[model samples]
Target: MSDQRESIRSNAKYLRNVRPIDPEEICEYVAGNPHPAVVRQQLREEAADLRLIEQDDGTFVPADDEPVSPRRGPVERFPAEYERRLEDLLVERYGPNWEDGASGDLLRSTVRRFKADYLDGRPVEYNDDVAAGYAIYHLPGYYAAIQYALDDLADRGLLDRTLRVLDLGAGVGGPALGLCDYLPDDALLEYHAVEPSAAADVLKDLLAETGRNTHPTIHRTTAEAFDPSEAVSGDGSSDGFDPTAPDDGFDLVLACNVLSELDDPVDVMQSYLETLAPKGTFLAMAPADKNTSVQLREVERELEEERLWDRDAVDFETSAAGDAERYRRGEVTVYGPTVRLWPGETPSDRGWSFDVRPDLDVPAVQRRLDENAPDDGEHAPGEFVNVDVQFSYSQLRLDGRRRIDMALETNEWAKMAEMERHVTERIDLVAAKLSRSLSGGDGNGGRGSGRSNPLFKISDGSEDTDHYAVVTTETALNRPLLEAGYGDVCSFEGILALWNDDEEAYNLVVDEETIVDRIT
Candidate 1:
């Protein structure tokens, strides 16, 4: 190992140009079964701070994009202190009338009502006093969701410029606050916020918390009612309705957590997309509920047909499958014209549950709980309810759209899948049943007759990867094929319908019956 290290010490110059070093592929230069120590030694010799980052899949990859220093963990921290101050102000606002001690139960109930109103897409007529309290309760979770969304945007090269942001229905400016935290110290940002709620009253105060880092302008109007032509374009000056005018549109448009509440959300989204400056992004996010997520998907679908934007979902899905399924790859600007849940975020049986910390301090609630104290003295008041949040988000843009006259060539799999889904045309792809080992079912291509839904993996003719899909068929549909088919499993080679899946693999349905010639 030492000899190899000495031999490759000259190679350190080449390694310096490679920022992120994949730990897996680091051994090509060394001779005959080089021990892992030699690789480590070479990496250290090249760059001392280079570290192996464990990905979500538990594999180590070089942290090339922006490597963290040493073992200090993620550079981003939740803005807990900034948020805590706002909660303190909420309690202070009600302190004057609390001499007799507040009702912890009432405040808790009010907070719960605030949350329910948000998810149910209903008006929050809970009064100004409770509105402030609700912000105190929900801001952390809102910040978390917006932070994750903005983090994703930042990673996609969308935030590379000095950001000019327009946040619609900006709830107390949470997305603006999250954006402020995401940018660099010297990175200038101009933020414009549109919100008609009483929550808008405090958005300036919250933006001020960023302390000299951001410039915020609050537009006090409902999104649908807000007119972009009349909007001040953040340059401290007014401009007429010229699209080519300076300071015309936003680089980042945020319709965060408020899409479902708008009167005409699709129309509002169309308006928002128009206000996007060239090379701009529009993001729409909602609570991680089934309805809101589904609505966002519908919005994504509608946007594809709109003339303003070229869709990115197809390229997004194709790249995810990488080059092996490059045949399935679509143009970077084209999409399925359909919006599905982002991968791994499919609503589970328990529904859209996101992580939250009920552990944050709630002094007023605590006082009320303390006053109403039981003799047993266990459990925090807010802990018994849902306080944390998860959400679904859709990020789209207008920069990549193919012009109206241009033709869109569909990929083979997408075409075949579409044929199966719509035309009811049968197509052939090599498919294997999803082994029942994961779901505790017998892998006999089981459906009904005391079996789980039939799931399968279709090969893409790629050795290292396979596409997993599921098809819904009754025992009757697959039974005939099986009689001609299996020694142990039902393997089919032709005429299957494309069903839903994680995009890497899918669920495909077989025809009612087939002659068994393609079985393996």
Candidate 2:
């Protein structure tokens, strides 16, 4: 092993610069290997200073002397059934005093905001392509674990029959809608989405327009304050909740990308896990971020005490590199895009495939060339490649029209276009070898050229290297590809497009393991 270390380091570039990793490929990697030493090291480094904050709800908040402002709102005036449950939640959490006029007005306003922003007609500014794209782009890889775990449950006949699904912190309803798209039409799914933001309204309207509202129940309630009873009427049935069917506890509970936000995710999960029926599936997904790691650890700890269902590691889905970076930076303002779960075994199900158009998915690869290089304005210190996941493969024939329509309604397309351009410009750099080869000029200047490949250089704030990386003799190549497939696969051709093709420079690497470790 020691002998192989030198080779691993020497040939790391060659080994790392592999093609895009598939969902199945990642599944196989986890299936084959246990946690690696580096992973443990990274986890420790990432978690070293971690201190568990004993939140009122039992979820650990990061140690911050600055108090987390209490979430304030009026008592919601949902339909009678939803109202009753909302009242019960108010009493249980905030004490009975929270059920009156001012509180009701506050809740009403918040719900109205949720309906307006996320329902069908309201509006808020969450439609930024960079934000949405970042979320959509990376969610699949992490979603893949949920898919695999759900499939395993289905294979076990656990998800058979019409199942009720509840998506907590359902951001733009990505996983909720993604699951809706993934499930069979006749699957008899009663989707009850709990999103407290205006974005929830946008998602609600989206589902309704797409005819997915046939059996949907949307509540503009935060996960902490969201009342399941509100989703299920007093008589244990769904009312104006779109589906308007019986509102028993959900058969499958999906909390994706939101756990990291809770003061006590376990308390939140515990609050809902009991709502699941025997043999029910509880799935949670989160970015393979520090918050997720802590949340998962906490959940595992809690489950150990409960002696509930077993857990199996699964594949890592894909999403935007920038989004993942935001998560690492704890800058992702929303959740639900990443997922975490309980009760569900490692899912083996192949979730929905991306259906973005080919042209849209395949962006032009650009290399920011150094003017003084062998080839003026030709050689770059680095390369930037973008793959439009939505455009990559539309085999599923998804009507991005609805999403696009929503995008247009939100008017985020222009912003998305601008973001794409901005990202491209940011990642464009001088490829060390390309600059050297360019200094040799055209094909006429062969080897033995005096020019040298540039080493690491800082990126202008304009680009988000959240996706790109530096390659050197000891640089690991596959890391990026791992990231790409996990979110957006950067093709070899895309790399070549940015290369000078002169010097022996390191190509991109897709480290599926590392990528999976981040968002799953």
Candidate 3:
């Protein structure tokens, strides 16, 4: 485990030169402590050089040498002052934890990590937050439900063997891949995914590497715009699709974790459901809330009208608060969130209460906070202070090995941009040291010297793997092997390793292990 940790750190150091400059870094490089006059001159030069290409292709390509390209989007060329204001706002909210101490290296490292795992490639989390989310969220069960639903449809021959499937809101393409794995080879399983996040890039990489039948046309675009009808003539190869023709649609349509964002989910479903062939099965997973209930009701109404409504209970509720209170009162923490414990195969037996806050909007909450600002740590009358957090819980159940892969999505790029400064600084410092070392002095000196590597670099970089430590006479699982600041990777093998290894010899620390083999 120590060797593996060292290896990851060494690799990080070696790849310092290969790190890409983040948008924030590019801004900083040009803004470089300039006087008012120099700043004006630079801004003038930038404006004089601006050029936009109006190409037939939808892509807005910028001039290659332009420092401030408008093609990436207006946000891409934000002024230095704007960035400063944004940083100040982040500091106010997240405190000093905002930028990892103003070093762009942290942001660069984050980007590099994202690129390495989820960006330009399939997110192969050896162990990380991406995986942990899957573990905690019980994503595997959702995949299982998809498979089961599809199998039920397939068994009845509802979808012909040649049917192609499109998975919407596929977080890491779990359901699409799982369905493919479960179906027979001759099923003609064509998989298409609709994801909106910049992580769509990651999904594409995964699709390419996994040897799956993926149509680039089937990626990145939203379902709203993915229709064949909307496709323009001469817009790339129809790629087995007719631009003017209605789709044969899909055999199975999987929509998970997507409907909640819509104000009119019913309309969205109605629009997309048309893409499914007649007698086609649509498996939808919502947050299991009132909003979800409304959407389900819409689906139910539509189904009943078509006489295809078949429902089953896939989840139950267990109150984490209720369980915590019981534990605090000197009772066993039972009847809490329906999580499977250790080798236990059953979910918790408890009813759950749903708390819906449709009235609370982000802007409204921010405004309220500003209006009722705490004066010297004292709350004003009628001030909105959250003494306790309110959370809604729903227990989802299914059967299968969970596929967990977590990578920082595109929305987090700005946050990661802040961390990039730290990473760049550290890299500069390391390079300086190396330069000095090669020169005359103590064999270590370059530009910025004597700085420690980022916390993540020091830690093992396995996001989809597990790390174990020896405890007493047994190897115990380090519940969360990685720190919160770092990435997390959880797996079934980690669970089994903890269960079987009550031994002392192999108690040191284990990074990764296969649990199925050990358990079986």
**Per-residue lDDT over 1-520 for candidate 3, one digit per residue giving the tens place of the 0 to 100 score:** 2333233223323333454212222233342433434323222222211211112322112222311111111111112332243334334543554333432223323434543443242433322233222321222334333443343234334445344566666665445544554544323345567766544543443344332222223465665656633321122323355311234545456676555544565566555555555334456654433344335434433332332111121233468655321211111111111122222222111111112111212222223333434354543443332221112222111112111112333332111112223221211000000000111212121112333321111111111111122212122332233221111122223322221133111111223331211110
**lDDT (CA) per prediction:** 0.49, 0.35, 0.32
Clashes of 1: 9
Ranked candidates, highest lDDT first: 1, 2, 3
Top of the candidates by TM-score: 1
Cα-based lDDT at residue 98, candidate 2: 40
The per-residue C-alpha lDDT of model 3 at residue 133 equals: 24
Kindly report which residue stretches of model 1 are placed more than 4 angstroms away from their true locations once superposed: 1-77, 96-100, 103-105, 116-121, 229-235, 239-247, 309-389, 401-520
What residue runs in model 2 are displaced by over 4 Å at the alpha carbon?
1-145, 209-214, 233-247, 307-520
User: lDDT of model 3 at residue 124?
Assistant: 36
**CA displacement after TM-score superposition, residue 70 of candidate 2 (Å):** 42
lDDT of 1 by residue, 266-320 (tens): 8888867867776666777776555776677567656645674332322333455
